[model samples]
Target: VEEAKRAGAKVVVVLATQREADEGRVGRQIADELGVGVVYLHGIQFSGGDEYCEYIKYTLAALVAALEASSGAAGGNGLWPLLILALSIAVVAEAGLLARGWWRGGGRA
Candidate 1:
């Protein structure tokens, strides 16, 4: 892990265990020690299933991103996609909250 960091690598650890995902778990400690990010995934069955395959796919993607980032070249697309996604979810949640409040109070405030 230290060698990887010295090589300008971002270590991403994908942990599929709920127990290890709890606070003060060993997985979190390892990530903290390595200064890496941990991707917590649930329902990751290694017995040849869709969720397992998807986890593998995401892990590969994360590795590629980390390697590509070592070149110090900025990607064309910035945080716009993530910002838009967050905004969309916030709008939907606000609408739901407002609808629920209005429905309960008969259209007031």
Candidate 2:
């Protein structure tokens, strides 16, 4: 985890037990020190195991939100909207061009 964080990857640590969640001593400490995300799924590991899947989804979403917020995207200070709009415009233009070409070809393959 430390090595991955050092390599510029986003790190998320999931604590599987209540004690681990409460303390997460080393994991939480490292996460705090490295500005990473930590999630506590106290019973997912020992319960039905299917709960782990649900918790995994939640954990991933939380991590993404945290990373986005940290990067200023969620704060509206980033270029996210501009980029999305640009991509939308590009897709629309491409679709129009394709439609025009199809019409010119009498809608044939």
TM-score, every prediction: 0.38, 0.40
Q: Candidate 2: deviation at residue 25, Å?
A: 0.7
Candidate 2 lands at a TM-score of 0.40
* Error of model 1, residue 69, in angstroms: 12
Candidate topping TM-score: 2
Cα lDDT tens digits for candidate 1, 1-109: 5775676445444556664546427656656777665555444545565443345455445544554453345665453454455456656666776788899998787
Q: What are the candidates' C-alpha RMSDs? A: 12.3, 11.3
Task: Tell me how far the alpha carbon of residue 16 in candidate 1 is from the true structure, in angstroms, after superposition.
Answer: 18
For 1-109, candidate 2 gives per-residue lDDT tens digits of 5686767644545555633544577767767777866554443444565443445445445555555655644556554564555456656666776788799999984
Candidate 1 ranges beyond 4 A from true positions: 1-22, 32-35, 38-78
Error of 1 at 70 (Å): 11
Best by lDDT: 2
